[model samples]
Target chain A: MNLRDFRNFTIRDYQDLFAKGELVPRELLTIFLERIREVDSLLHAFLFVNEDRAFARAQKLEEEGRDRSVCPPLWGIPIAIKDNICTLGIPTTCASRILEGYIPPYNATVIERLEAAGAIILGKTNMDEFAMGSSTENSAYGPTRNPFDLERVPGGSSGGSAAALASLEAPLALGSDTGGSVRQPAAFCGIVGLRPTYGRVSRYGLVSFASSLDQIGPMARTVEDTITLFEIISGRDERDSTCAPYPPFSRAEIPQEEEVRKMIIGLPREYFSEGVDSRIVGTIEEVLKGLEKEGLTIREVSLPHTSYALEAYYIVAPSEASSNLARYDGVLYGLREGGEGTLQDMYFRTRTSGFGAEVKRRILLGTYSLSSGYYDAYYLKGMKVRTLVRQDFERAFQECHLLITPVSPVFPFFLGERTKNPYEMYLADVFTIPSAMAGIPALSLNCGYVDNLPVGLQIIAGPFQEGVLFGLALFLEQMLSLPLPLPEIGQQRRS
Target chain B: MPGHVSLEEVRKIAQLAKLSFSEEELTRFFQDISDIIAHFEKLNELDLEDVSPTSHISWSQPPMNPDEPVDWQGSDLVLKHAPCAAGRYFIVPKVVEKEEKLS
Candidate 1:
């Protein structure tokens, strides 16, 4: 096939080609590597490309041969992994200088599952330092640019993975979302991303950011491709105490038209508040109107606690982050500083030098919140407000099967716009943080484009109700029929 | 209970967190963190006296595993990443110092 066809191919299409004996795993790997080489310079999507290991795995898969009945679901598929998730012998830096040159000795449970399912790892993608920033600009290495507009950010923490999929460097990728890490970037890059239920996926290998809110999710170009990867990565693992005792998710069938027609969709009024850009509101309304004509019931719902979610998230996330990052002292792995001085001096020097500006800010904020005198007023209050956020979703779901909202307040913003203002960066996550606080599953898909930039529509469901999300996303995908077009960078290279 | 944060408080927090910063950095961080905390003060507006805190959101009981220790085969691999390691043990700066006896 030609370059144009490769850019549009999904996991299912590749699987069909392999089954028909028309393509081999190694050949596909070469095509992906070539595309990455051509465009990665401009996008900066990947931090490391596992060229040798990927070729070896592809060769082994070729030698074993593709036996459709016996082969794993993701057989011969190449996928990108965010830098925060551990992969044995691969550098998992989380885009921070503290983890510079650090290699993991063990694979994260998700990595093990993906490898077992016959997926090949392309390499680790860049992310915000310790996953703290909403934009990828916080990364010490560099920020990943949006594929659609070279000057705009690719939405972040998972920005690298989203940009890679949108540019067709990889068909599938894994990203960890705490707050809007997965969905926001997916919305900005114009691809599909899902933040599974808090315990739906194991967290043994993901670098701890905010333990209560962190979850591994899947990102791809289409809804079905996302489901395939999500089913493989999600399940129970005894290693993580927080992981639920649920069975592995199975591939869900597309719901029939009648089943979808009977469902009621809720629009939380707080998600469409005045802060949201009028263009995004208009785009989502048009999509909702289309769904209404398709026989689905649309109703207004109130989630009163929505305004408090951002404030609570900022406090809670940093507090947990401060505690989780305490392991980075000079005694163990990672960077060491002030070795000639006393132990206390070493710790002070190492942490101060190792972390970036934003990371340091978060660590300091967390330390202040969890300090002895202020614990009750800051940290405790944040958790209590978390309960109110959870209650809001619990009450909303009682009336509707699922909630639909805009993924981000604005479109993919230009780089350096919000970098200097920490509060503005935090505000970008207002729409997605409520579901994260509630520990529910949420999905982001492109609804339409405003001024040539994509608008993301978020679908949220009750705990373990990912099937509902997939069903609605599939229906909306069919209705929108917006194919993954070649991003501007790719188009420029072609010309 | 006070909303205003002093630079002295920022220094104390830095000490507690085991991190040291330059004077310029301390001043900037003091300003930024005070702004963030001032914004977080909005949480106090909600009267959550009757609401209990949610530490975890999962509905399932945390599965209990047997308290068994298993041998790890990757000890060498783990030590390979340590910044200061001698064989299997990690090296650290001296934590104690000699002092003259009290007279």
Candidate 2:
């Protein structure tokens, strides 16, 4: 096997070559490191690249002369991790100045599983500060530009991971999705991202945003690779109480094609409301017609409380964020600023200077919502709306096997377009936020292109229903069969 | 826009969040935050008095792990990330200073 462009290689491609003795782990690692050095400066995808560690790991694996047949599934394949997920001995900055030099003493459980599967940790990618913003512009390290169009923003907070994959910096990546962080970025970059059911992937090491909504899952160039990583990282962990007790997920668990084809796809009418771009709706409608022609049924469904999802999400996420982020008070970990007199003064100054604008905005919003006079009105009301949102999904699923919607209402916008308008940024998450509130499994696949930018079609399933989600994604992957070409970083126009 | 939050309220909220902002920033935040809260007011249109708030969607009681102690190997490593640490303890400014002598 002659590997021409290593960036084009998928997990299976690399595995096949390794098993055939035509390729080795060390050579693959070298290619990626070289690729990162060449392209990453333009993308700003990675915050820290562990050149020495990755090379050493690869050399060690090669020296072992390990039998490929008996090794872990991801043996020798390199994967990037979002900066928020902790990596032992590596700084997990969450793209914030507060954690500039902070390093984790232990790895997140998902990291442990990835290592056990023999996947190489390439490096940590940039994100919205503490995963608070729609675009990665909020990142303290500066924004990760879209590889497809240098002038536009890559939908974030997982923008770096998606950009990395789009640029062929890494074959696979892991990112946390709290209200479309993973899926939105994936859509913008023309890759695949899955947010497993909450508790499906252990959250033990993920830095919390909103504890209830945060979930870490896989991002890759293909459905097969996403499922492969998902199956490996999923399962219960003692450290995270919220981790579900479900048995380990596997390839054998996916529903058969016939069963998947028989499934009814629901198009939530609320998701197709007025502000959504006509081009996006046009693309989704075309895909729906194709799916119907393929013997699958499509039906109009109503998720009545959908309009309130954003409101509820804003309240709950920031409320929890305000509570969770209170831990970074110049005490145990992260940055510390001096106080003139009191410990409280240190906390005030440290947090004020350390956090970025979006982060501070959310913190204030959260703190106000959960504060004494407003808790009952804002936070509690948001919680009730959350219940209504979940109920809406519950009712919708009763009529259909799964739900399909646009990942974002519009295509990737130009960088700085929505930076000044916070409301506009929040609206980007409208369609994806409901499923997140419901704590269901959702996957984004590159369905079509609006102009030169790729448009993603999201498929959401009931809790612990990743198997069905994967099956539907696989069917769509085969049916669409669209060639996803790598984006030229310099080009910012229609292809 | 019915209930406009004043600058004083914004200050109180910032204080609650352990954050401090410049006067100009506070003014801008007040407007931005008010607009956001006005959007959130859409929730008041629905009658959800009977609805039980859901903190999480899962109904299953999480299975608790055995209460046995496990060895922790990262104490020193964790301390290494602290901005100021004396041995394993994190150092902070004095919270309670000597009472000022009566002037």
lDDT of 2 by residue, B37-80 (tens): 88988998999989999998773458788999999999999887
lDDT scores in order? 0.90, 0.89
* TM-scores of chain A, one for each prediction: 0.98, 0.98
Tens digits of per-residue lDDT, candidate 1, A126-158, equal 889999888899999999998888888999989
Give model 1's clash tally.
0
Q: Per-residue lDDT of A1-495 in model 2, one digit per residue for the tens?
A: 322465455688788888888889888877888878877888899999978888888888888866755879899888999999999999899999988898999999999999999988999999999998888999999999999888888889999999998888888999999999999999999999999988888998999999999999799998988999998999889899999887668888799999987989999998898988899999989999999998999999999999999999999999999899989888888888985869889998899889998888888888888878788889999999999999998899899989999999989988999999898899989988999999998999999886678999999998888888899999998899887547766756556
Off by over 4 Å in 1: A252-254, A490-495, B100-103
Alpha-carbon error at A112 in model 1, in Å? 0.3
Where does candidate 2 chain A have its weakest 10-residue lDDT segment?
A: A1-10
Please report the interface RMSD of model 1 to 1 decimal. Answer: 1.0
* Prediction-by-prediction clash tally: 0, 0
TM-score of chain B in each prediction: 0.88, 0.86
Off by over 4 Å in 2: A1-8, A493-495, B100-103
Best by lDDT: 1
